[model samples]
Target: MPFVKTTWRNSISFKVLLAYVAGVGLSILLIALGAFALITSRSDILLTTDVAERTHELAGKLLFDAAGRPTGFDDSEGDRVWTFKSLGEEIGYRVLDSQANVALASTDQAFWSPVAKAAPSEQGHFKFEREGIPMYAATAPVEHNGATWYLQFAVSERLMELLHQGFAWPFMGAGIVLFSLVLLFVFGACAYFTLGYALKPLREVSESAATISPRSLHSRLESKNVPWEVAPLVRSFNSALERLEQGYRVQQEFLATAAHELKTPLALIRAQIELMAPDKGRDSLLDDVAHMTRQVQQLLLLAETSEAHNYSFAVVDVGEVAQQAAAYLQRMADAACVGIVVAGPADTQTPWQADRSALFTLLKNLLENAIQHAPAGTQVRVEFTTSRLTVRDWGPGVGQAQLPQIFTRFWRGAHRRDHGAGLGLTICQEIARAHGWTLVAQREEPGLSFCLSRHHAGPG
Candidate 1:
C-alpha cells in the first residue's frame, strides 16, 4: 500500500457554505410564491366585484328619471336601453319595445351606436367581440312610461385599459420594492446558514489536531471542511509538518548506517595495532599496548551507539542478547580453547529497554573479558537467572580491595596491571546505566562474577 500520512487527515477539517445558501433561497422562493399568488388572486377578485357593482348601480340610475318615470326602460321586454342627460353630459343606451330600437340617444353620436346595440330583452347581460375592440355593457328591462319601455346600457373599452394603466404599474413597483426588502432578510438568513457550514471547517481542524499521532503524521486535514479562505494555512502547516518528520527520519537512518559502516574500519585498525612489536623489558607492555588500542576502539564503538550518539532504543531480552554476543566471540573463544558456556531457562520474559548496538556491545565485552582471562581449556560459564546474567571464568579472581573501582573508567587492576586496558568494565557500566540497569564485580575464589540487574523493581 502506498504510505499515506494519517496525520493531516486525522487533523484537518473540510466544510461547504453554498449548500446552505441554496437551501435558504429555495425556501424563500416557495414561501414568496405561495403568498404572492394568494394575495394577487384576492386583489383581482375584489376589484372585479367592485366594478360589477358599480355597473349595476349606473343602470338603475339611468332607468329611473327624477320624476320616477322609467323613461327609456320597458316593464316587459327582452332588452332595453336608457340614456340619461346628467349635468348636460350625454349617456348612451338601447331599447327593446317588441323590437330592438334606440329608445334613448345621447348627444355624443360617436358613442351611441355601440351602446345602442345593447338589448334589454336579453335575460342577462351579453358580451362579445366586435370591430377588434372590447366593450363592457349591461341590459335590463324596466318601465319608463305607462307603456312598456325596454332599455340597455353599455360601456366602451377605454375605461378598463385606463384602470390598469393608472393603478397596476405603480402597485407592481411598490410590490417589487416590498419583495426586495424581504429578499434582504432572506439573504441574511442564507448568509447565516452559509456561515454555519463555513465554520464547520474550523471544527474539523480542531478535531484533526486532537487526533494527531506519530503514526498519522502524513495524513492531511480534509479539504472538504476547509474553507477556501483558510485552506492555504492548513495546507502549509501540513507541508511543514511533513518536512520535519522527513528530516528526523533521515537523521536517524544516517546515524544507524554511519555507525554500522565505521565498525569494520575500526576493527581493522585495532587488528593492525595488535601486530606491532613490544617495547621490550616493559613486562607484557606489548600486550598492554594492544589491549589498550582495542579498548580505545571499543570505546569508540560504544560512543557511536550511545545516547550521546543518535541512538534509537528498543526492547531486548538479556539472555538472547548474551547468546548473540557469545556467538560473535565464538571464534576467539575456540582459538583460545576457552570453553564458553551459556546456561539459563529455555526463555526468560525479563527484557532490557536499550539501544540495540549498546546492548550487544555490553554482552560482547563481558564475554571477551572472560575469554581473555581464562586459561586454555578453562571453562567460562555464562549463567542467566530471572533478573541477571552472570559470567564466571576460572581466571585470577579480582581482589576485594579493587572491586569497587573495577567499573570506574580506565581503572586498571593490579592482577592485569601490565596486560590490559582498563575501560572494559567502565564501558559495560555505561551500557548498564543507559539501560537503567546495574553492573557489579563480585570477587570469587578463581574469577570475577559480573552481575547486571533490572533496576527499580523491588516490591513492598
Candidate 2:
C-alpha cells in the first residue's frame, strides 16, 4: 500500500508520445516555411530568366547605317508592340522612355518592385510597386546611337500568391503522405519489434515480481537480460524495494521488542501507584508519568520519521508558516529568555510546494532545538521566501567533526542539552526529501543557520 500510491501518475509512454508529436510538429513548421520560400523564389527566378533571355535576343538584332554606326531598331514587321513586349512571359514588364516622365507598365505591374530597385549593375534586377500590388522587375539597359534604351519587367503579387498557393498544397500533401508512410512502415515496424525485444526482460521481471510476496521481496529482477537504457531504472527500483522490505522487517522487530519492554515497566508503575498513599508518592508518580509520556512521544516521532508518513506535498505559504510556528514556540522561547523574532516581511508571499504541517513541525523543532542550545537572552530569527526558508540562532556554532551527522536520527551534537529526541533535524531533512527540497545545516560563525531551499529547476 505504501509503494502503490507513489508519484509516477504521468507515465513514461505518454510523455514520449507527446515529445514525438511536438518534435514532428516543429519539424513540419520549419519545412513548411522553407518549402514555401523555395517554391516562390524558383517561380520568380524562372519568370525573370525568361524575360532576360527575350531582352537579350531583341538587343542582338541591331540595325546599322551606311557609316557602320547603330542607326535604329530592327523593326522587321513594323510591329513596335512586339519590340516592347516581355515576349509573353508570366512575370515581365518593360520601361518605355525611362529617362523621360513617361513609363509604360504591364497589367500586372507590382512584380516590378524588386527588379526596379536593384542597382543598374545587376543585369538590372530591382523592386517596384504599381497600383497597390508588389512586384519583382529585371531590366537590361542598352545604348543605341547616343540614345538610351531600357527594358524592365515585373512579377505581380497576384502571381506570387498564385505561385505559393499552387505549390504549398502539393508540398503539404506530400509531407502528409511521407510522414504517414514512415510512421506506418518504418517506425511502426521498428517500434513493434523493438518493443517486443525491450519488453521481454520486463515481462520476465514482472512475472518474477508478481510471484513474490512480502516474504520474498529480497529476490530481484535479473540484470543480464535488461536493456541498457532501462537497466539502471530497474536496478534502482530493485534496490529501493529491498531497502523497504528490510525496513519493514526491522520495524516489525522493533515494535515487538518495544511492546514487551514497555509493558513490564508500565505494569510495575501501575502496581506502585495502586499501593501508594495519595500524599506519599504523588509527586514521584506525576514525574514518572510525564517521563513516560515524553518517551512515548519520542518513539512515535521516530517511527513516523522512518515511515515518512508525516509529510505530504502541496503549496504552503512559508512566511505565514514561519509566523504560525514562531507563535507556537513563543511561550517556550520566552520561558528560556530567548528572543524569537519572525523578522521577514509580512507582505511577502512565498508559496512553497511542500507539506504544510511537516514544515511547521520542522521549523518548530529546529527553533526549539536552537532555544535549548542557545546562550540565554540570544535572538532566534526565522525568515522565508519563495525558494528558501532560513532559521538562525546565536548558539555556539556546531563543531567541525560533528557536522556530518547532525541530521542523522538520534544524533546529539556537542552543544547538546536535554533536547527531547535528537531526531528534530533528522525529521527536517526527511521532510525536505519528501518534498524534493534541500535541508542544510550551515555554520554562521558564532551561530547556526538552517536552510530549507527549493532546488530551482535550472542551472542558476
Candidate 3:
C-alpha cells in the first residue's frame, strides 16, 4: 500500500486521474449543498405562511364571539369550545388579550414561553430550544372587537430533524459516496486511455530513435501525426544529428589520412636504424621508433572501433580466443615477470558470431594492462565462458574513486607502468559498446577484474 501511494504520487498518469476525480467530486458536493439550502429555505417559508394564516383566523373567531354571533361555540351555555383542532400534534399556540394575559390556548398546558421576562416581542419569528426540544416559533398581533390580541405559535422541530436524519442526510451522504466512486472509476478509465493515446507518438519516437546508430545518422524523426508540442523538439534533434554526422565523417577521414602519412616515414626510420652499428643508443632509438609505431597502430584501431565502422562477424570459439590472446602476449608477460593462465571449459567448442579482430584487441589490451601492473611472479588469470570472459591480475587494484573514470578516453591513474597514451581501456569500452556488450571493472581483494559479457548479437 505504501508503494502504491508512492507510485500514485510519482506517476503522471495517476496524478491526472486523481485530479479529475477530485474535481468531479468537488462539483457534486457544491451542487448538493446548494440544493439542501434551497430546500430548507422553502420549508421555512411554508411554515411561516401557515403561522400567518392561523393568526388571521384566530382574530376572526374572537370578533365573531364578541359581537354575539355564532363562533361554532356555545359560551352562554357555560361550555367553552376551541377552534383549529385540525392543527398538528407537534404544533402549540397561545392567545393574549390587550393586557398580555393568557386568554386562550390550543394545548391543555402552556408550551409557548415569552422571549424575555420584562418585555416580549410583539411580532416576529425565531428558533429556540425549549426543554431540550428545538422549535420554530412566531408571534403576531391582530384586531378583534375594537381591542387587540397577540397570538404566539410554535412547531416542534423533532419531526423535521428526524426526517432529515432518517432520509435526507443519509441520501445526501450516499449520493456523495456513490458520486466519488463512479467518478473515480469512469474518469480514471477514460484518463488512462486518453493518456495512452496522447503519449503514443512519443513512444514511436523513442522506438525510432533506438534504431538510429552512428551509421544511420541520416535518419530523422517524422513530425507528421505527432503532437504539436513535441514537433519542434524532433526537428531540433534531427538538426543536431546532421551536425554530428558531419563531424564523424571528418574525424574518420583525418584518422585514415594521418595513419597513411605517419606510417610511411615511421617504417623508413626504423629500417634505416636497423642498418646502423649495434649500440645502446642505436637500440634505444629503434625502441623509440617501435613504440611510436605501436602507438600509431593503436590510434588507427581506436578510430576504427570507436565509431560505426564495419566489423567482421564469424563463428569464433571463446576458449580458443582466450588461448590465442594468452599465447600472443606470453612473451611480453614473461619479460614483465608475470605469468598468464587461461581457465574455462576444457576443449569447449561453443562457437558464437562475433568480430574476431575486435575481440582480440579487447583481450590483448586487458592482458597487457593486467601483466603490466601485476607484481613479479604473480599470475594473471583469464577465464572464458560461452557468453562471458573475465581477466584478473594480482596487482594493486584501482582506487574506488578512479574506477568510474577508468574507461574514459585518455584517462590515466597515479600508478607506475609503461608510458603510453591512455587509450587501452577506452578502446576496449568502445569495442564492447559497438558489439552491444558490457565491460565492467571491479576491484578485487588484491587486484582488479574486468568482465566482458552479453556477447550475443549478430552483425549490425
Please tell me which model should have the higher lDDT, number 1 or number 2: 2
lDDT of 1 by residue, 84-194 (tens): 444113224544564654545444445544444434565355443334555554555555556455554444444444555567645865776677666656766776666
lDDT of 1 at 207: 92
Between candidates 1 and 3, the TM-score winner: 3
lDDT of 3 by residue, 176-201 (tens): 77877777788778888999898799
Which whole-number lDDT from 0 to 100 does residue 336 have in model 2?
Answer: 82
Q: Where's the lowest-lDDT run of ten residues in candidate 2? A: 100-109
Q: What TM-score, over all chains together, does every model reach?
A: 0.36, 0.45, 0.63
Angstrom error of the Cα, residue 352, model 3: value is 2.2
lDDT of 3 at 163: 56
| Candidate 3 weakest lDDT stretch, 10 residues | 69-78
**23: Cα error in model 2, Å:** 42
How far does residue 303 in candidate 2 sit from its true spot (Å)? 2.1
Backbone clashes under 3 angstroms, per model: 38, 25, 0
- lDDT score, candidate 2: 0.67
Best by lDDT: 3
